[model samples]
Target: MMKVANPPKVSPPANEALTKDARQYGVVIGALAGFCENGSPLVSLGDRPALTAMTLVDVGEQHIGMRVAVQFEGGDLGLPLVIGVVRDNSGVGSSAGASAARVTSECGLSATIDDDEIVLIARRRITLRCGAASVTLDSDGNVEIRGKHLLSRAAGQNRIKGSSVSLN
Candidate 1:
């Protein structure tokens, strides 16, 4: 008689009759419709009913037309839960919704609302880098940098007024 090398592990048969939870991708059609006691954002998903999702702990806002991933209840037992947002599909840099302010990180880079007031607080140092310019502010608000600089530019005229003008 031939001996079996090893028996393969077998999983118990799934109960197809019962609802099975699954993860799915969908787009956020509506937002800010309502909120749960825990402050979870309730949003209407594409074609499906509205459901509340566990958002980022410090997420200030979620807007419509944002693509999101959701977890569907097993065997269609109940509404699905929003798991996370799909960043690549999110039209962040486009001018579609230019009026709104959005902050996000994608592809190893962080994007902030252009020309908007932003405050960065760091215990040690804060560094910003761009292809054209960079800024650094130390804990004591003293910094040194190398670059062509501009103080201010206005449509009508540029003014530089100070107690004393010294050029070296």
Candidate 2:
């Protein structure tokens, strides 16, 4: 019987091999280039090609030019993960007064909260619905209200002023 030579040991994939090597390098700073088709952010690390990365912090389109800390996820087969944003010591972006929080949704809805008040915005329409009652506001300056019953109560003066008003 002819002895079969041992098969050559196949190496891991490039990313997998890079992952092992990357561990020793620790976290790297990368800039957010843009977003991928699946909405994941693409980051540029040094001179390498842009790699798709997921974020541990809340990141949006506003963060496209910001630097972020990137590291390979240990259990995720070395997929790049954005751990945090790198903020400069300069107080340029920081507010001296009350801090504000902004949240943007995937569907074009956004909200901003500050010390004074909260603001909600939507591209097309915004609707507030509770049980059988619903209030809809559209970009065309149209407000529609629907409910089983409607009530109008005011502690002070109540006024209904519009281009045209109809009552039944």
Candidate 3:
């Protein structure tokens, strides 16, 4: 009778080691490479090739080189999803006391909140509009207020001061 020997078990590819390792089942840090044709983000995990991924947090072209935390759904065979952006801690101590919150839009609108004040910034103009009333502030330092009927009332005094005050 001939002796029979079992074949050796093959190991998984090195790139797939992340999913195979039980210890790495948790969130993994990845760099945002770019976006696919379908708008899905492509992430690079260490030396592995970039893989298309979904994101729970909003990501734009501006965040292409940002670091993000990726979590695999189900298990090693599940899809990869970007959970959150990893904030850079280098500037953590730049603001000592006040905590700031900021929101920026691609259309050149930004709002920032720091301590007790809120500041709004825009590239061209900032306008507040209602039914027939609108106030506009332009980049040229022009302030325009329009309304059907305008009234100025103050508890103590009301003053209208400008380079040249006009009343008609």
Candidate 4:
């Protein structure tokens, strides 16, 4: 892949550019999962794993489950964040969505999916205009880039529930 491409509507998040005090870990979301004690393998086992792919429906359970472990996990979140975009093996939109915007917006930005191309609201905008369409889109066509790298485990408890996915 190219190092970078032309930006969309918005600019990238500032957090990714930090250079100090960063920690990494895996993101898991689903119904139920188990992380290997050795951190080697993750399996679905006809159900789900510790690192599960989840939707908004599972928020309640995920929140309560991490409470006990929050007092034990640790790490730093002040460093640059590098992420890898993740997709279902069959790819996105193929899951048969009901919305006109095939791809859901990450955190409210509009997005859409066209074959393999993902057009999204690039957060890389130089100026922050309230109604600029160039850096602000109103569609559902971005490729959701969810990474496997873990965020800082020491920042507190599991603060991120539906992990922040970027438009790749």
Each prediction's Cα lDDT score?
0.45, 0.69, 0.67, 0.27
TM-score per candidate, in order? 0.30, 0.43, 0.40, 0.17
Scored against the true structure, residue 69 in model 3 reaches a CA lDDT of 83
- Alpha-carbon deviation at 79 in model 2, angstroms: 1.6
Regions of model 1 farther than 4 Å from truth:
1-38, 55-59, 62-64, 73-77, 89-168
lDDT by residue (tens digit), candidate 3, 1-168: 775598667445345554666245578877666665578877666555567777899988667556778886544423568887777577311221245545443344555557788776778888878899999999999999999998888999788787897778
Which window of 10 residues has the lowest lDDT sum in candidate 2? 91-100
In model 3, residue pairs whose N, Cα or C atoms come closer than 3 Å (at least 3 residues apart or on different chains), thus clashing, are none
- Model 2 clash pairs? none
Per-model clash counts, in order, read 5, 0, 0, 30
- Candidate 4 C-alpha lDDT tens digits along 43-80: 12112112322222222322211211110012222211
Cα lDDT tens digits, model 1, 35-104, are: 4446665544433444655554323344433445455444332444555555544544112233433332
lDDT of 2: 0.69
Better of 2 and 4 by TM-score: 2
| Global CA lDDT computed for model 3 | 0.67
Best by lDDT: 2
> Which wins on TM-score, candidate 1 or candidate 2?
2
**Order of candidate numbers by TM-score, starting with the best:** 2, 3, 1, 4
Can you give the lDDT of residue 136 in candidate 4?
A: 31
